[model samples]
Target: MVAEKDANAAKEILQQFEAARTQVGELVTAAEKNNQHFDQLIAADNAAGHAIINQAIMALVAQTGSIERAAGIIGIDNLNPDTADHEF
Candidate 1:
């Protein structure tokens, strides 16, 4: 009878461990999805900012007739949109 009781207790412990592991796995999956969504949003925002900067650079060049002067107004050395770094 004591052996039967111990076996039942062991089974219960095993079930609890499995439940905890499943819960942790679900949490990790959710977190990964959230991170991906956040990354997409950041990328879209960066692209939009890049477009606006290019527009401003073009307008400045048209008005000033000098790309260097436009770049100096924005406090950057080179305003070339194609080669500019967009890291923030």
Candidate 2:
């Protein structure tokens, strides 16, 4: 009877070990999913940043076009004076 009790205790210990290992496995899976989410966020942020830059560039192009059209109507030269000396 004593040997049977010892065997039962060992079996309980083995069960506990398996349970602990299962918990660890679950945690590892969760961590991997979290890492993938982080990577997706980083990629999305980069794409958004590029979109913002593209919008700014488009806005600047529109503004410059307006300036040139206004200058053409007024018959005024819009040349920069800083580089005018190099033309000679």
**Which number leads on TM-score?**
2
lDDT of 2 by residue, 1-88 (tens): 3224455544544554455555444434534764433244335556643443444445444444444444444556764434334432
Model 1, 1-88: lDDT tens digits are 3224455544544554455555444434434754433244335556643443444444433333333343454456755543255332
Name the runs in model 2 displaced over 4 angstroms. 1-45, 78-88
C-alpha positional error of residue 35 in candidate 1 after TM-score superposition, expressed in Å: 3.3
Error of 1 at 72 (Å): 75
TM-scores for every candidate against the unseen true structure: 0.32, 0.36
**Cα lDDT of all candidates, in order?**
0.45, 0.46
Candidate 2: lDDT over CA atoms? 0.46
Candidate 1 lDDT (Cα, 0 to 1): 0.45
Alpha-carbon error at 46 in model 2, in Å? 0.7
The alpha-carbon deviation from the true structure for residue 22 of candidate 2, after best TM-score superposition, in angstroms, is 54
